[model samples]
Target: MHQYVFSGLRVSSEFKFTIADCEPFDGSPDVTIRFVQYLEKPLHPIFADEIVTAAPNDVWFCASGDLAYRVKDGSEILIQRGENVPDADVNLYLVGTGFGVLCLQRDLIPFHCSAVEYNGHAVAFSGESGVGKSTLAAALSQLGYGHVCDDVCIANSAQTPMRVQPMPKGLKLWDDAAAQLNIAQGARVSADLDFHKSYVNVDRADQTGGLMFNRIYILDNDIAPEFSIHELKGAEKHAELRRAIYREEWLHFLQEPRKTFDLVSTLASKVAVFAFKRPDDLSRIKESAKFLALHFDDGDAE
Candidate 1:
């Protein structure tokens, strides 16, 4: 029997898997997986034959003709097919694909951002792909900033004060960026990459404390060359944040738009948002980080 823990959740099972059938390990106690009976469902049009959805728990386990069990909340929920999971210190589950959903039903507001810590506060960089999200995060880490999460970040806004969770160590970067970071050759990128992607870790410097989010920079290609910050306000700001909210890879469960909308709206109201743009020059990425640190520090003086 093999046991895996994630976010303090434990899963024990007696099963063996080959090297070709393993998935990337995520240490979380909220999930426990074991092989089980084989069941099939209609495949989604977009994902085609690669994925399937299950009833009852609505948890989408990877489909591979093998059965697996996931134990949570003291209840054994069967995961049709998946990989070996690990024990995690923080318990936040990214529910569906392309959207942010918290496994816990607490009153916390979860935001979709790549968060890092600088001078004890969490600064989240929220934006779309090709917008240099990971690049900016890596630049900050190289300059003494601490990393919390590169792509996905979870926050507990329901508490008396908001708190951010530590994302899995490492940032996924493009091939060019990987070369700049000097990752080993032929290293596998994230599981979903086909051409240009790689992972880089910044924890070698200093790893400690989840920084409270003090600033937000929404990346856009249409802005001026210089770095500027804006305070998000009103319904317009809320709408932008909703559009920027991160989506999970398993988005089939979130077929209902209302569920997605309500969840994202609640997250945006809790944090400050800013618009960030870059010129042909890439140096602005670092400038943006320093701009944020200085601006926040000045605000503290007032």
Candidate 2:
């Protein structure tokens, strides 16, 4: 039995299951996830057998003759066939459901970014879905940077210096971007129906050493091909950090939203933000990568 730990939770081998061999759901959630395996075969069935279609937001599922079921709560969920579950300390079935669980937990302020270790601190690339977040991270990976997280990045902001946890070891890339990264055709893990994601270890790359983020670049396609690394203050910076925080669905679950908001606000204040432009030509990806590397290295030395 194997045990995998993330954030503060422990996943044990007893809950492991395979998605490839498991049965597929005829009616799946809006977020298509194929890797649905249980860490511990639930004390009983965890999902509903019949699809209960209602409003898109109200859709819920339960395994026939079983009390356990999955209810849609703005978070993503996937159940796939023959997906293998790894051994861990926790026995809850949904603990390993997807990155959403970790993202939504009230304890962590999750970010929708691709994080990598640069020097000793973590550098996170945050922005909108198609804003080249993963693309930039993949580019960094090729340049010898280590990966920490992809879409869902969990962090504890209560400490003097915020701490982050590694999500799953996977990179979700669009079809075109996957080709650019030279990832083999068969080397992807399915996240939803439309997207194909790949997972790789940071150590596998030539880069070594963790990076303490001295700068954060927010991808802005609307802007001209330019760069602005500046200090943000006042309500504007707060708004930016709020927008960058991931797992919005879970915000309502918090006992006090203001406390969470304040914590995030403080964390964002401690980091630097920059606006980066997306290059017009594909040939300039390396140039963009170099720009980022030099920016961090230079800033860290000062």
Candidate 3:
């Protein structure tokens, strides 16, 4: 039995995950993941025809080649790895998609952002998959901001200060970005065959949150000709949050739309949301991070 703290929960897993931040847990874990072979389809018809469907407190899926995952009330995750047995891929699905589903079932707000701490607050970067959220975050790490989590932001943790929780291994970036930033050499754990991405240990977790989650920066490459940031308001604020739900594909079968809506609304009201635009040029990633730090470091980022 391997134990670690992940997404604000003490997680016990049957297999040791390479990148899980090391933390201690007493008694029993808050969540358990048991690995098994051969997942018999659910006996009910609730998700008979779909690849993925999420109910109020559960999510069922039979995707990722032969892998099948069942998330129950956020307490346990039963994974049938089937023939999809690559360790790298397994960790990817478990942390990325699987944990995203668990956060939803557990009533936590999942933001598709790379969250980093700037002077004791979580300033998250929200964007589509290829918009360089991870790369930008990695750059911020070089500038001395601590990494909170990559890919998923579990906002409003049950703990004090209203900080977002940290996920395993921060700043998974393209291979080129690794050299460009001149970061410490790291193991290559690419999720794709092209081998363009690798997880960099830039944001090693020293501890979990005491800082509050403050601002969200939404980025779009096509919209902004130059790097710029502006505050979001009214319908746009709520709408941007809706569009930024991490692993949003699972939301299609979410049974508690009203509950989810209320959660998003509360989150929107609690913090500020901003839209960021930068040209699609990948070369300016460092400059963009500097611009963000200038505004965010003083706690005046709007």
Candidate 4:
């Protein structure tokens, strides 16, 4: 068995993951992954589609890539891979959408954002796909900011000050972004062979514990020439945070409307949210990072 720490949860899995490995612990794992030949579907499923059949704590997900999984009680995952499916394909689902569902079952909120350490606080960049969240984060890392996580920002919403757990993952960038940042020549691992995305190492932050998640920037590509930051207030804050929920489609299966609302409300109240707008130009990404650094400096001065 291999031990790994993911989003602050100590996991024991039958198969090794690309995540940061940890020494084996004495106690039972917070989460476990087991390989199984077959999995029985939930007898009483609350939500059933062609691909997913989910109950309260039992979910059977069948991916388009011919992979299947049964995640139970937010503590265990049973994988049933299709014929000749590679470990990489299985891992892609396990870490992304599967983990998002697990977070909901554990009462944790998963924000689909790129998080980094800036001025000793976890700052998250969230927006729609292809909106350059990871690109901006990679640029910030070039300027000495620590990369916390690339894709998912998992938060412990049970606490007063929501803590963002470090995923401790390499920055995954497309081929263009990698070349643009001039890190293409570095020793990197291919994240996805088909997508031409590669995982390049960055100056990672401390991965032992969670950081106080403070700020969230919703990246927006605007017609403006220069970068602009607009503070979001009241309903705007709440709305932006709600829209950033990772795999929000699965939230309906794990029905907890009041809990979800409370979590988002508390997050909006504690953290500052802003609309970070810039021109849709990848060449000026370094300038964007500089602008953000100066913004943090201005905040420190105030």
Q: Rank the candidates by lDDT, best first.
A: 4, 3, 2, 1
Per-residue alpha-carbon lDDT of model 1 for 1-302, expressed as tens digits? 45543212243433332111223344543443344555344333333334444333343434233332332333344434334332210111222221133232222334556766766677777776677877777777776767767666556555334556544535667777656655443434434336566555565323334446546778776757576666677786777666565553333443345765666565665666777655645645566667766765765511
Q: Model 2: how far is 67 from its true place, Å?
A: 15
Alpha-carbon RMSD, each predicted model: 6.9, 9.5, 2.4, 2.2
Q: Which portions of model 2 show Cα errors greater than 4 Å?
A: 13-104, 191-215, 249-255
Please write out the lDDT profile of model 2 over residues 24-89, one tens digit for every residue.
Answer: 333332332223344123223332224332232222333222222232333333342232322211
lDDT of 3 by residue, 1-302 (tens): 88888877888998678787467789888899898776554444344455775555676786567677878888888888766467776777788777888887777767898877766677889888888888888888888888877888777634444567767655677777877888665666754577767767775435445347768898875756677777899899988888788876556565457866777777776778888887777678789899888778565743
Query: If both were scored by TM-score, which would come out higher, candidate 3 or candidate 4?
Result: 4
For model 3, name the residue pairs that clash: none
Candidate 4: lDDT of 130?
81
TM-score of each: 0.66, 0.65, 0.90, 0.92
Clashes of each: 30, 44, 0, 0
Candidate 1: where are CA atoms >4 Å away? Answer: 1-29, 36-39, 42-110, 181-186, 190-193, 204-209, 248-269, 299-302
lDDT measured at residue 163 in model 3 versus the true structure, 0 to 100: 69
Please report the TM-score between candidate 4 and the true structure.
0.92
Off by over 4 Å in 4: 185-193, 221-223
Give lDDT for model 4.
0.80
